[model samples]
Target: MAHVRSSAIRARLDWVRVHHGQARVEEVIGALDRHELAIRGAASPNLWIPFDAYVALNTEIDRRFGIGDLSLCRVLGRYTAEVNLPTLYRIFYKIGTPTYILSKVSAVWSAHYDSGIASSRPVPDGVIIRVESFATPHRCMCLSVLGWLEQTVTIAGAELIDAREVMCRLRDGNACEFRLLYREP
Candidate 1:
């Protein structure tokens, strides 16, 4: 099974606690506990946990807090970048262009996920990120990535004009791609 770093899971729960309050965090943990994916206690930042558990956490967040279309997963993803980038990956944003950051995605991808190869290429007004070979990819996961990429551009000192998923492995069974259009600040 694919795995995600524990820090990613912790960040999701942290966002919930900060925005929704401690009670909601407990409710979320209760929901996940039913599925045997307990996340109430902290885990080692670098520990690898089942990616499915991460997905379950995202799904639960969307089910309770979102509008049922799963779009809120994207919002949660943007929050992930907001919480994570400034502390853990700040230097990349400080010195890297959007393109430079895109180039480093592959390396970053490996650290966060045990599956998938993430790569990017420059487009006319932005960049196209492609995620391939991810085991058990889901639309919620893809949308989260779209949000993450959009936020990353903003953190890199650019104004994001548009961002959307161009392709999804769930539909095409190949890979997922996101198109992000931005203007330099």
Candidate 2:
């Protein structure tokens, strides 16, 4: 079974509690408990947890709070970047151009996920990221990545125009591809 950093799960739960209230979070936690997943309040951020549990948590969040289209997963992902990146990494975003920042996504991929290698290359107005070798892929995960990349460029002081997942392992078979277009700012 693939594993994900516990921080990912914690962040999602935190978002729910903050936005929906303690009762909603408790409800969500109850649902997850049925799946045998535990979200201890003091769980270590560096600890590893089952990736499917992470997915299940996201699925529940989307089902309860998200638009039926799963776009809220993308929003949650962008929120993750917003909340998580501005602290220690704010300087990197300020100093780097969008291209410079995006090109380094491959290096950062392994920090949050134990599966998948993200590779990127410069395109005309943006970057193309391909997430390959992901042992388990799902639509929620793909949308989250797409949103993260979009927010990343915006944080790097670029004006994002469009972003899309052109291919997904869930629908297309092998890898997931994301295209993000930006205007220099």
Candidate 3:
């Protein structure tokens, strides 16, 4: 079973990385769309940061400053709406220590509002960083993750679909994977 699962994951990665050249989120989304994977709301016209670039940024920060308490890093992308559709900028953040792999961080937004009724504000979307202490095979972190995902999706009026896990380290020198996913409303 482990072999099969590993093989399946490898195959998926190969398809996404080799065949589709998923150097950017746009390419990954395109591949997903080509495979009939559903995405939340209308597609945005903005380009997504390449996974490597995003990782490099975080790794560099970690190496330079060392993990400190209350350190936050964010990656931003802009999506433009076409044909009366609302376009949103999705920002993903990597929070917490290197020894403990937690969750992915995401923020969904439409327009830029500072205050008042028309002020554009950031709506927290999905589990950005799944705390390692909270995740155990027996404990099933899915419930908590899903709870956060559901709330964010509901508030954003978007649909979220699949979740992907990326290997990362925690502050305690433990290796783990951080889970990330796309949603559809």
Candidate 4:
């Protein structure tokens, strides 16, 4: 499986546990093996983990909760929307209007996603984010990521903001594109 920074995955589990309590978390991580590649418990925010683990954890959460992808996005969206990121992003994301913040989206996303996924760059009005595919594996990830982007901007002082999955890779398009629109207060 591919590898991704642990910060992206561990934080979500921590959020789930912190907000929902241990029993709910144990319901998922307890049965999974924490291998040298992936730790079962709270992983270091900077640790490296197999991407499969991230996928597995989400899949397990959905199966365990009997929830759909949109609901899962809500869980993560609320968590991310409410918290300020580290010093760098807290300032970077808030310094500009929603459009400007999104113009810099690639800066932060680059840290979490591998190059194979796609590339992001600022467009004239919004931003263009392309992904490798929109298959089953990427469906939930795309939705949740969109949710995160929406909330991230919302907290950053944007009075109005919108993100849409305009193009889908599953639809035989070149890549999945998220169009960002916003009005600054």
Q: lDDT of each model, Cα atoms only?
A: 0.83, 0.82, 0.27, 0.62
**Candidate 3, 1-185: lDDT as tens digits:** 00011221222233334434656334443434322232211233342322232233323332333352212121111001111122332221122221111121311211111111111112243334433322222111222233433333333444455433333333342333333343433
Taking all chains together, each candidate's TM-score versus the true structure is: 0.93, 0.93, 0.21, 0.78
Could you say which candidate leads in lDDT? 1
Q: What value of lDDT does candidate 2 attain over all alpha carbons?
A: 0.82
What's the true lDDT of residue 44 in model 3?
Answer: 37
TM-score of 4: 0.78
| Residue pair clashes in candidate 2 | none
- On residues 83-180, what C-alpha lDDT tens digit does candidate 1 reach at each position? 87755467768677887787778988898899999998999889889999998898778988888898889898988999998888898748899999
Candidate 3 ranges with C-alpha deviation above 4 Å: 1-128, 134-142, 164-178, 183-185
Error of 4 at 91 (Å): 3.0
Q: Is candidate 2 or candidate 4 better by lDDT?
A: 2
lDDT of 4 by residue, 64-141 (tens): 664755457545644654552777767766776666666555555556655445556666545666666323345556
Give candidate 1's whole-model lDDT.
0.83
Off by over 4 Å in 4: 33-42, 69-71, 81-84, 117-125, 132-137
Q: What is the C-alpha RMSD of each candidate to the true structure, in Å?
A: 1.7, 1.7, 17.0, 3.4
